[model samples]
Target: MEAYWRRTAMWYGGVGLLAARVVRNLALPPAYTRLVVREMELMGVRSLGVAMIAAVFTGMVFALQSAANMARFGAEAYVGPVTALAILRELGPVLTAILVGGKVASGITAELGSMKVTEQIDALRALGVNYVKRLIVPRLLAALLVFPLITALADLIGLLGGAAIMFFERRADPWTYWNVTTYWVLPRDFLMGIAKSVVFGVLVTLIGCYNGLETEGGTEGLGRATTATVVHVTMAVIVSDFFLTKLLLALFW
Candidate 1:
């Protein structure tokens, strides 16, 4: 039991230190600016299509479920708030992080692990290039910065998805849908979800980079690291979400 606790503590401590180093490195102006641009490209532009697709499907499915359920109670008007609350408070950020975890985490880990195995990382060291600054930091910055934007996009798309169902299949009154969405949805809900996503982004990057740096056994090692990065990141995101949700619910309610 003591041994397990020590290992767990060390693991989290290392993650914390890595995150701190990433933040410190990001404080340099030129490097920070470049990372921001690079991150926008990697996280935002690359992820737009995926977010759109997921959002549409999520919205559609949500509407189908909510409309069916609410119809039974003659409370179909509540569908808008149901969808809005679900997207803003839960599904939007969580699903967005999952997508980012799969897309960004695996790609970064594979790239870095391949470099580490090929001795390119060593060459960068020989040439006085800070690999963490050049490679890892950009990705970390990109993932951290872009995740919330992606979540925001997902939130909007999901609402539209629900709205589509309300307008078309459910034949819900558009004015009522609009009014409920605007009036009943709390601001804190969106803020909490976005805030959770940022934490998830940081965790994803840290875990991905750590896995890549620790990779061994050539290609096999790289593959293992990539897999591990995705799995651990997804799990961490969910676990963190549970705690954050509990804290927020307690504080707010």
Candidate 2:
């Protein structure tokens, strides 16, 4: 138990140090602005289709379930607000992070792990290239910037999805649904969800890059690191969501 606690402390300490290094390196040199834009396209633009698909389906299912359950209590009219609250406050950010994290983390770990195994990273260091600036900073910056944008879009698409279901399945009035949703959902709700996504974005980028840089043992090590990244990032996003929700509620709610 003591050993476990010590290891946990060390793990977090290392993560903090890495984050600090990322900050320091960003201001140093090369000013890889193009690379940052490239990463944004890779991490954000490529990820849009899946996030929207997930959002639409999630909204549909939630609206379907909520309407069914609430109809029994004669509260079906509130389904729009309920769906909006759930998606904006919790589901949109959480699901988008998990999906994009899982998709991108595995790719990052595998790509970097392969480089490590093939001594390409060593070659970069030998060339006097600041790999932290060249690699990690762009990716981390992209994640930080991309996730909130994606989540905001997902939130809007999800509400549209729910509205579609309400119209088709429940025959609820669309204007009423839209009005109720707008009334209940404050700008704070959007901000809260975006804030949570930003944290998740940081966690995903750091964990993925950390695992990749630490990869050893060649092909087998790459496989293990890739798998571990997905699991660790998913757990981190979810567990942190609870704490972030609490903190945001205290500050804003």
Query: Looking at candidate 2, what is the lDDT of residue 32?
Result: 88
Candidate 2, residue 226: lDDT:
95
List the global CA lDDT of all models.
0.84, 0.91
Model 1, global lDDT? 0.84
Off by over 4 Å in 2: 1-8
Residues 1-253, candidate 1, lDDT per residue (tens digit)?
9999997788778778877877787766457566669767976798888887998799889988989988999988888988999999889999888886677888878888998899999999999887777877878777777889899989999999889988998888899889988888889989988988888888888887877777789998898889978888888988999998998898886
Off by over 4 Å in 1: 1-13, 29-32
Cα misplacement distance, residue 36 of candidate 1 (Å): 3.5
Please provide, for model 2 over 1-253, each residue's C-alpha lDDT reduced to its tens digit, 9 standing for 90 to 100.
9999997788678778889999899788788889889989989999999999999999999999999999999999899999999999999999999999888888888888999999999999999998889889999988989999999999999988988999998999888888888888788888899999999999999888888888999999999999988998899999999999999999986
For all predicted structures, in order, the TM-scores are: 0.90, 0.96
User: What's the CA error at residue 244 for candidate 2, in Å?
Assistant: 0.6
